[model samples]
Target: MHLSVSCGIPLIAPCRSSVKLPPPSPGIFYGRAREIDHIIDLVLHKSPARVAILGPGGIGKTSIALTVLHHPDIQTIYTHRRFFVSCETVTTADGVVLELLTTFGLIHDPQQGILPQQVLLNHLQSLPGGILCLDNLETLWDVETRATEHLLTTLASFSQLTLLVTTRGSRRPMHVAWTRPFLAPIMPLSLDAALQTWDAICEVHNEYSIKLVHAVDCLPLAVTLLANLAESESSKMLWERWEHDKLEVLHTQDSDNRLSNIEFSIELSFRGPKLKDDVQTVQCLSIICMLPQGLHESRISLFADAYSQVLPKFRSSIALLQGLCLVYSSDDGFVRVLSPMRHYIQAHHPLPDHLLSQLANIYCDISLAVH
Candidate 1:
């Protein structure tokens, strides 16, 4: 008697070799598993909680949302059905509605002379349960839009789905969104965790105490990118290249999963037309950057000359920037940078000598306030 194993492809008692899969992105990618579990529970419960992963860029807001989607507990809860809209390519609100229509497996010509918002709301209402992860909402839609707010409230209060948002925006309409910690200072990587990250990024092992110190001062994105660079370059070379441009440390795209660490985040925080034509705004903000974090308004007022008549509204503008997640208040009473290392790198750019002297005056005011 002869027994044979039949297969689709010819199998001559073939030697099966294991196919190796690529490693995931580097950096200390530890997540808030407890928070993720809570989010899943919120989605599963009758009353859902809308989470807005709020923080500065490179602080890993999207990373948390993506991780939660893949969590085993979340998979069991959502049954692997979730809608993700990159929203990077989406410029208008109508684009969101179209993305939703496709995600829900509904077929309809977008050009059928029907606007997408109506189609989307109706379709979303029909689904029994779904979760929509809206990444980069600020970049995609107007924060001040009544339509956007209505859409958010409807998704939470009316639809079967929960909306998980990640943005640098404030937690307005408190019922609609909850602020998440992106700073990671509470559970920052231990030296061991950082070393593990280096090993994960490089082909061979390379770990040093000095490198770890630099990483401790770095945002997670920079740390991971550096770890990967260790594969090809000497540590001295990497550090020297990234020296003044500390943000340059975050440029490695090899760790695709770790894109949350992309250096472009620094630029995104700046270069908004919102700041155009506001020289005083620039000087005032730059002065704030120069001063220690969380300086008092009284001290800031001394720099009223920093912005002419505009300085009277410094409080409001600072609040606006803070709400935008470009900055955050500290427990120590200083408005420390939302991403400190990036701030230092950004603030390092050359300023007119006159401006630097003005900034020096602003700095002196803060010291006076301390005294």
Candidate 2:
């Protein structure tokens, strides 16, 4: 495909039959060539558009965006001046506008100590159109629902600029004129894809294929972490220990303050304040585990009421389960937990000892009461 030099728009294929792919970067880019193609179309297509790639955290949203923007066979339109803004730091919509103005070397003095939406609109209208990348787009919205939506709507309507956003939030206002992938699977690696990943890892770490896959769970972050870990220990020995306690080791909190990569990710999920009845909650989940694969929810509910003595809000329990990424709410309002329970039930990071004692006391009280 050829590109228009003056306007930076991608043009018709010079030789319709022979399509060439750009050279890929050597870093940790995984699946999603198809998603990247759509993104390239949005940004380099002959019109202005807003593109968004939305998905779960640590799921390679940023990596995929970088791949399209940096492709060596890529058109030079965006690379000349791609503005990378981290939306996580700038706290408000006004701040986001100010940040852009400052980055572009424009006079950024807010007229009345606050930027009017039109002022931003006019400024963007004045500047030479460029690709504006906003990562973690859902962050900085705070609790102001309307303000976030309003800013998004205004940004998407910019006359000449192309905006690409990476977020884990819903795509509503930002969905205006853009085209990007809407689905949210990690896009599982195919056999060819798997070989590509293993070859990439083996080139550096010299590990066997199947053993590496087993240790890392085949996720990009997991593979990267374990590949680095292989420099210190033989892959065989590591796999042996990992087989014994894979989930626990994945969140290995004691490894020199270094996140054993993917294990470090779960740390974010643990940041909020601990549950008030955490001891009982842990106990409740453990009891639920003892049941069969197709365990009944009513049975679990009855055990929760009996053992905890206090009836917990079913909603709170459901929210906790969701936050753990362990369970999903079914159509019938039942909760289905995800695989591999030993991490929660028998892992080192158990509920507080005090909470455990309190849970035991509650169970004894309930038992006596039942008699």
C-alpha lDDT of candidate 2 relative to the true structure:
0.52
Q: List clashing residue pairs in candidate 2.
A: none
Predicted candidate 1 versus true structure: per-residue lDDT over 149-187, tens digit per residue: 555666666445667877654544343644233222222
Each prediction's number of clashing residue pairs = 5, 0
Cα RMSD to the true fold for all candidates: 11.9, 10.2
Give the top-scoring candidate (lDDT): 1
Question: How much does candidate 1 score in TM-score?
Answer: 0.74
Best by the TM-score measure = 1
Cα error of candidate 1 at position 89, Å: 1.8
